[model samples]
Target: YVAPNDSFSRGVKYRIDTDKMEIEQLWQYGKERGKEFYSPYICNVTYYNEGHYLTHSGGIAYDSEGNASTELGPFAKLEDPNTVLKSITVETVNDEVALELEVNSNFYRANKFTLYAKEEGMSDLELGQGQLLGTLGETNQMDTEIPAEETGEIVSDWHEAHLTEEVDMLTFQAKFEPGTLAMLVLEGEEETRQYFISTSKGLRGAMCTGTFLPEDDRDTRTVVTKDGLDGEYKVKLIVNDKKFETGLSIRA
Candidate 1:
């Protein structure tokens, strides 16, 4: 629909049923400089299943009421029509897991990142061993990666996830004892934690840390932790269930 600067133009709304797309055009009264006229243009375009799998366009602008689908900044200046995602890096330091993630959005949009983890012998992914430790905001060029472990008690800041997306960036420091052909389980009904395992001398055990998605099928696996010091080995996870087999040791 195109409205003339001097006259009114009747516009029509069209719906594409096969693609499940809807487009609307409406007429509005406005002044162009010193001239009075009616303007006809696409007022709104609503795509079906917008929240599920499809993406739509609305000129880049932030919504005051807070909506995720809305553009983060002035939509007209968006570099790409499709969404652009930032990059992330994960590493181990001082018996802790560190994460450096970047988000490239026009505006500060509420965001979440999820990392899944598993040990050598496990049947699923587990979040119990991976704790959320900290977060750093968006960065340019390179993101700042810091140690996930602290000298004090683990804080609650890094423990929440929206559905399958873990809300935090930092993962906790979880140490595992050494043993081969071991079946380690997390404290949840969802089978998590059956992933790759490695050891370092200073920590005196195996370490696994990263973000985890709570919903997924469990994959069985085996893990090896480091061996013997004279003390009882008790393992604790954020979720339910007791895991790990007895007698995990590394032979000299």
Candidate 2:
């Protein structure tokens, strides 16, 4: 059966094969006023005998020609899960140095990892020699609330509202040391890409969001830092025990 609607230029096509006990459906949206538009679509398949169902939903941006131009799927597939290091930045928060790492991954579960720092030419795997900066995935969750004083004044006492917006962050604790090359190593799993920390200023105290994982439909930000180190340094991200390397530099 096919049902067409002109309200928003949308239509649905559905078919049923009773002999095979199978059902199929397709939903589509067409362009409006010779302009592009965004449409959300869903598809579902069910096997009545086996009582199994599979569903998929996403938003698509259609061009003027009624063709899908972009797919914004909200689901993650873990068959070959991987991580991408989006960016590394260093900033000072309240006189404390902070190193922020923006990462994207396809894994729902948090991976155990540790941060290490050593002299530029030193080996990152030398456990005894390399400084253990901090550890993550040891705790299930962490929460941090920014006090009202740090945020601003209360705007309404009766309504219990504040003038400045208070920020609450989910975070994990990590020690950051300045003046050394920083490296993050996953405990058991090999990384798909290597990340190197290079900056003009040294690192200080670091915090990360604990509950957020790569599969949470968003990017995860991890920050680390130490105090009192500044200057330019070339950092290399080595993957597979130096099999590949990417370089970047940070200025303060």
Which portions of model 1 show Cα errors greater than 4 Å? 1-81, 84-103, 107-170, 173-238, 244-252
Per-residue error (Å), model 2, residue 56 = 9.4
| Alpha-carbon RMSD, each predicted model | 22.3, 23.6
Which digits, one per residue and each the tens of the lDDT, describe model 1 over residues 76-180?
Answer: 113323433222222223323343233332222223224444556554755576664553442121122211222233323222211111232212233333332
Candidate 2 lDDT tens digits, 1-252: 222122222233457899999989632222331212222332222221222222111122333344433322222112112211111112223323233222332112122124655668654555355455543322121232111111122211221111111121112112223333333211112211122333224222211222132332222223323122134322222111232112233322
RMSD in angstroms between candidate 2 and the native structure over all alpha carbons: 23.6
Error of 2 at 117 (Å): 51
Q: What 10-residue stretch in candidate 2 is worst by lDDT?
A: 160-169
The TM-score of predicted model 1 comes to: 0.14
Give the runs in model 2 whose Cα sits over 4 Å from its true position: 1-57, 62-169, 172-220, 223-252
TM-score of each: 0.14, 0.18
Scored against the true structure, residue 212 in model 1 reaches a CA lDDT of 19
